[model samples]
Target: MSASAKKQSIYEPDQEGLYFPRPPVFSTVAEERQHRRERLAAVCRIFARYKFEYGFAGHVTVRDPEHPGLFWTNPFGMSMSRVKASDMILVDHVGKVVEGTWAVNQAGFVLHSAIHEENPDIIASCHAHTVNGMAWAALGRPLDPITQTACGFFGHQAVITEEAGAVVVERGAGFAVAKAFGDSKVAIHQNHGLFSVGRHSIDEAAWWFIALERACEIQLKAEATGSPLKLVAPEKAAHSAKHLATPFMGWLHFQPIYDWIIRTDPDLVD
Candidate 1:
């Protein structure tokens, strides 16, 4: 290949007739709503696969395309492993279950509702009590740029100290969390666990949550060794984050997981 062809292949491989999968576009709100619901269901199953479950304490939500005030979330009391698209519940900002027969989790409603309400740009949000995430959050500090994977959250992560470890069931508590979130994509609620958001798709939110949990685990394990850890330089970490931590990248990285989920647990969409 010519030099120009090689450069184009590297930078714009999907420019023309390439087979890269892109986020789907829908013609109608109904079609888009169904897509989001299925994706949310898949994310829940993905969380289950990653063992991010803790007696239904976790929640992943995707905003309704037509009705921005509402979102779809896993039913309260349902295991992430068993949640299906049809079992997902539609909830309004006021904590009302507008659709679906199953009840909504109050803690989930308080936090996710405030997040979706306060941030119009956020299309999806995920929060879970994973073992590593909880352990890291207990330290009440943000992850250091110790690895390239950790670099993804170098400047994009926040640590919310207010209401630390408190159960987020009150409206005011939820609002506090959202206020701390501001524009960051990931947050570690002090003494709680991980939270992530997506401005683009549920795939992005889900993937970021998974990535954040893994990063937390890696950092914890590294620190446990007691040797001084080498930190990535600020400039380099920022550059790495710019390219690797984008919403598009998160969505792209999730495609394989989505594919695997559909193939192995096809009933999630039911």
Candidate 2:
């Protein structure tokens, strides 16, 4: 064997791309389901790595590929850092745990189920109690596009003021939050935290939530300095948002984070 060949890893991209190559194609729904399970577990670890965990306050869900109406989510009360593919619970629309031993979190059930039920286009949802998101939600206003990161949500984000500072444990409250997501991918639940949805994959949903939180923190920090915030022009912010806010864009951005988690927390896939 050539020296170069020995130096290369066993894996290789099927095709080349400027960003990442096209992900592998799955011939059966079974393969895709496992892929999503791994992705879900990876998302948990990624958020944990970034200190997004707040005593199991965060939850993410992806529609089951085999059963479109059902979804897979991290088990209730599980620490975010310790969530594994084996710990994922498969729940139906009615909040019943059809698979896994762990009970589902009522908050995850109420909030995620409503969004997944209302939006057929949305296949995944992410919600978390990030400090910055909660801080911004306290303001009870939409995010101003003061930076490129914030612009990623210029026209695709909204604020939910109904259940301010309250946990949404009822189906009605959950439905109300879902309604606030009208035509938007991100929602800052007033005095709560953040909620983001992805059309195709939870990768996008998770990445968008992380991005939105960081943007909120940046905005808050920038404002606290007592300096005038230089807001982006509406047209420019819209254009930038259009370019950065797509589901695929978020999924692509998550690839490295996914890989990082896989390396650092290999047990997440157990």
Best by TM-score: 1
lDDT of 2 by residue, 19-93 (tens): 433355799999999989989998888888888888868889999998999999999898888889988999998
Model 1: per-residue Cα lDDT over 1-270, one tens digit each: 333553311234635665776679999999999999999999999899888999878999999998888889999998999888899899899779999988888877798889888899999999999999999999999999999889999799999997898887888889888999989999999998999999999999998999999999999999999999999999999999987788888988899999999999999888
Error of 1 at 11 (Å): 6.6
Scored by lDDT, the top model is: 1
lDDT of the candidates, in the order given: 0.89, 0.86
The alpha-carbon lDDT assigned to residue 173 of candidate 1 equals: 85
TM-score of each: 0.94, 0.91
lDDT, model 2, position 149: 92
Give the Cα error of residue 239 in candidate 1, in Å.
0.6
User: What value of lDDT does candidate 2 attain over all alpha carbons?
Assistant: 0.86
Pairs of colliding residues, candidate 1: none
